[model samples]
Target: MKVAVYPGTFDPLTLGHVDIIRRGAHLVDKLVVGVTTNPSKEPMFSVAERLEMVRREIAEIPGNIDVVEFDSLLMEFAEEQGATAILRGLRAVADFEYEFQMAGMNQQLNDDIETVFLMADVSLQPIASKLVKEIARYGGSIDKFVPSAVAEDVRRHLGAGSR
Candidate 1:
């Protein structure tokens, strides 16, 4: 089985993320979406909440996609899951530098695993979880950036009226 691990904090899954998930699902027998916690950034939602929200958003995708929470090194988690590859999404040139470095480190840690990079769709390229959260912080609409389910959760957390 060709298993691939797509690891991310996924604090609140945006549409760009769903786009990558959908495309990545087609490339592997099983795509494990790792909902992890990033100590560098303060997340608005708990890991449990983020997992639940990701599950809800991906419920309709017809594939062998599983959502799980992990707090270990991504390469270790991928190895534990028996993944043959690590799936990542690239939005632009700026993202490639950081992603490339991580991919190299992951390769060094586990030479058996490969890293696959998927380019975000042109229309969704501008949407990012950080920017989405910033917009939601001050009552800005994120309806276009994230799935409705995620937007609702963000709105509820931000104490904003539902649209």
Candidate 2:
């Protein structure tokens, strides 16, 4: 069975994320969505909270999608999880440049594992977790940027009214 790991902070899983998850689902037998816990950036949601939100959002996806929180190197985690590849979503040239370097580094760490990059749907090409948080932080509507459950969480956390 082919398995892939998709790693991200997912402070607030956005529609763009869900889009990639759905697309990545079709390409692998199982997808382990890793909600990375980075101490460098203060996260809005706790690791468990972010994992729960991602789990709740992808519960309907058919291909055995699961959420886990990790703090160590992602390539190491992927190896331990027995994933054959790391799935990533690319929205623009900037994303490509960043992911390319990371992919190269991951390859250096684990020669067997490969990185698969999926292009985000054009409608969501400009959407990002940071941008979504920014919009929510200042009383902007996020109904279309995040799942209904995630949107609610962002609203409550950011102290804004629901869209």
Best-fitting candidate, measured by lDDT? 1
Worst ten in a row by lDDT for model 2: 154-163
Candidate 1 on 15-100: residue-level lDDT in tens? 98999999999999999999999899998888988998989889999899999899999989998999999999999999999999
Model 1 error, position 85 (Å):
0.3
Cα-lDDT of candidate 1? 0.92
For residue 80, what is the lDDT in candidate 2? 82
- For all candidates, the clash counts are 0, 0
> Distance from true position, residue 56, model 1, in Å?
0.7
lDDT of 2 by residue, 30-143 (tens): 899999977777788888889889999999987878788888999889988899999999999999999999999999999899999999999999998888888888789989
Measured by TM-score, how close is model 2 to the native structure?
0.94
Clashes of 1: 0
